[model samples]
Target: MTTDLVAAVDIGGTKIAGALVDGTGDLLHRVQLPTPAGESADRVMAALTEVLGGLTRHASWSRVAAVGIGSAGPVDARTGTVSPVNIPGWRDFPLVEGVRATTGELPVTLVGDGAAIAAGEHWRGAARGRSDVLCMVVSTGVGGGLITDGRLRPGPTGNAGHIGHISVDFNGDLCPCGGRGCVERIASGTNIARYALAAGWRPADPEGDTTAAGVAVAARDGHPLALEAFDRSARALAAGIAATATLIEIETVVIGGGVSQSGEVLFAPLRRALREYATLPFVRDLEVVPAQLGTDAGLVGAAAACWSDPGTFLAVGAAGN
Candidate 1:
């Protein structure tokens, strides 16, 4: 029997990854390349084209039924375009069209990276079996999505449950997104490291270990400044999660990404702070947990997006669950 597959692509600021994924959420064959994000739009597309070319040359390409792409976004599924915040060259770039052109008539599905993570978690990861969920990626930046009524609701612009940019403070520092006291401004990995450094939390091995992971290690060792930084970031995340729950009544908040790798350092304080902020009756019972898919969430979620009716060039969505 021939195994059916979906070609999945995950495009982010740092990397571009693609895989041939089966129905049961397994990545069969994969390839990765650093993204030329700082290059011209054509140059970036050229790199993406090279990725698809690799997939097409694979022996299993014959069984591929569809193509799914999850890109760092402020994507417009309505128009089959993307304007990812980190990739400056691709403002309203016709990503769907470009992919379609690459893979011929194969149906392509496009969704924001946040929405992609949501679909992945809801379909098979931490938020599995939950009808309502908020899946967040808290790495160099914070991105999130919503799953409601047993379905991924990526919304019109494919950036619906973007809790990262939600204002948690009115008189706070300015975020690059032109917002004040946004969740990303406080809780992202970059901000976590930034806060620790600003507060004189130097790492024991100061060569290149001053990142959030280093902070986590220091926090575990009882460093006051490092612990304080994680706590502050957790507080901001708690506020954002509580706000989202208050607005739409999500059942679970699934946290993933680089910063989330801190395990207890991030989750322990986040749970404590969530209890303090989620005061309302309905929002109080919200469960916060780790993501099961780890780094594969984006690729798996991209494949899942193919099942959604996000109105790409071709309407066939496989949702290979």
Candidate 2:
């Protein structure tokens, strides 16, 4: 069988999604399972295995030449180990080895979710034309990766460009990652809802919706507390983006994931906050925009990150190796 596609896995705090992606960056088959993030490491691996099994059963599996995993990190690419902060059970998890065992020993490439998103966006999405860019996913946990000098630099340990973990407040709440006032502690979807609820905000549909999405609805309805929650998240996000821009000179930032879906409720304040933080002349022109790839950024980027030839990313159609 002609191997023209890859098995792509996108691992986040909330979900473990998989896809059979062809060279054209199209997902021929997709599957997903909620991450048992709070469960034991074995349980999390089971969820990941199920998602991967779904793809292996697809007819296109024969065309899958490799496996690409884009996971939440602090990942050690050198040793194929991962220590994701949000998933407490996984400390130094041998993800690549485990994946290889599940995929019939196919070649596996591991990269941080942020790096994978950056790879996908730089390949075919929002950051396509930019040499210096930051692609972020603002979901249950905030994460980011960088594109610098027209290359996807995931860093040696696959932990570079971790904007979400960057400290934004010196005397703020302690984060799950053992840091005080990290951007993810304030700007992630989980934190957004947590903060809003703590402020006595009521969700529009509190029965089954107390998430950031619920808060977004209330914010749109002009609820002060909901608005304040999103604004606070935006402020932290903006500060982190600005700090990254100031350090790396990245000109554009692509924000995606669930929180970014809140539309104007998030972007409006984010843009406004950017003005307050990104005041440096060189960083002033930094542009923050929504990701074009939407939810597929992670999967597509996983495919892109594993491409045998990096130039394959520029192909809009059937460009896999």
Candidate 3:
């Protein structure tokens, strides 16, 4: 019998990537498209359909068994309804059924973007051999996924891993989630710039703004304000990670995305802060490292989701007699 092919799609705030993948995590027929900003859900669906059609037409796969989607937040994975705050048009949208209908009756799996990343890491990335790990994406926004005992924990409807929203400061900035002191409101790239601006690091064109990478460069070049901003963000992230480590006793924390590109600039202070905060000696040694798969993580993760059996995405390490 011929091997089954799966279609994996990862939808982010800026871009959408999809690929045809085999069970062994080999991705083929990759394609990418810009996510339509401020468009209605139907229009977004149209965009997805167009891209999927192009991919299906170009790829020479005999049979497509399933389609898996890893979408931005507030998605109900059980019902497949996506209500992401970033995607205004996606309120209560039946994403899995919608994709299924669009693809003509193929099985569709809808999962939170965080869960997808975790699944990807579990299947083939940094946490491949581990049983408990946290996969974090620190980009425009900070997102997280949890895999405990090698199983994906999506919480209720795959939205449980909103680590960015965890309150780091009691009297800090107000968040979109109606909370104060959310980690994302402070440490996300957007907030990093916001904090930098608040500290008087101004550019000629404020609207054009500085990126996390640019800030890292400026910090390395001896910009005091940028260095302070990075320190503050790192402190917040480390605190969050320490708290997670304490609560869950995680084995590893895998970080990915744009901010993580800062390399040691981001990791050093984070490690320092985590060490300072983690009172327990065991939690202090929790491995924190950059993601191995890089940009392909989302695609690889989506494919992992496609191959996973629902409610049992976790893998158990083999028992030694």
Rank all candidate structures by their lDDT, best first, as comma-separated numbers: 1, 2, 3
Better of 2 and 3 by lDDT: 2
Global lDDT of model 2: 0.87
lDDT, candidate 3, 11-123, per-residue tens: 87778888887777778788888988489998888777776876678545455676778889878776678888888988988777767665775667777888888888888
Q: lDDT (0-100) at residue 106 of candidate 1?
A: 77
For each predicted model, how many residue pairs clash, with residues at least 3 apart or on different chains? 2, 3, 3
Q: Which residue pairs clash within candidate 1?
A: 306-317, 307-319
Q: Measured by TM-score, how close is model 1 to the native structure?
A: 0.93
> In model 1, which range of ten residues has the least summed lDDT?
312-321
Give candidate 2 regions above 4 Å deviation. 57-59, 203-209, 308-321
Query: How far in Å is the alpha carbon of 141 misplaced in model 3?
Result: 0.4
Q: How much lDDT does each candidate structure score?
A: 0.88, 0.87, 0.79
Best candidate per lDDT, number? 1
Judged by TM-score relative to the true structure, which candidate is superior, 2 or 3? 3
- Show the lowest summed lDDT stretch of 10 residues, model 2: 312-321
Model 1 per-residue lDDT tens digits across residues 74-137 = 8887788889898999999988888887788777777889988998887779988898899999
Highest-scoring model, TM-score: 1
For candidate 2, write residues 1-321 as lDDT tens digits: 788888999998889999998887888999999999999999999999999889988988888887888888888777788888778899999888778767985777788889999989998899998899999989888889999998788887776789988899989999877889999999999999999999998765558579999999999999999999999999999999999999999999999988999999999999999999999899999998889998889899888887635634221111111
Q: Report the lDDT of model 3 for residue 312.
A: 32
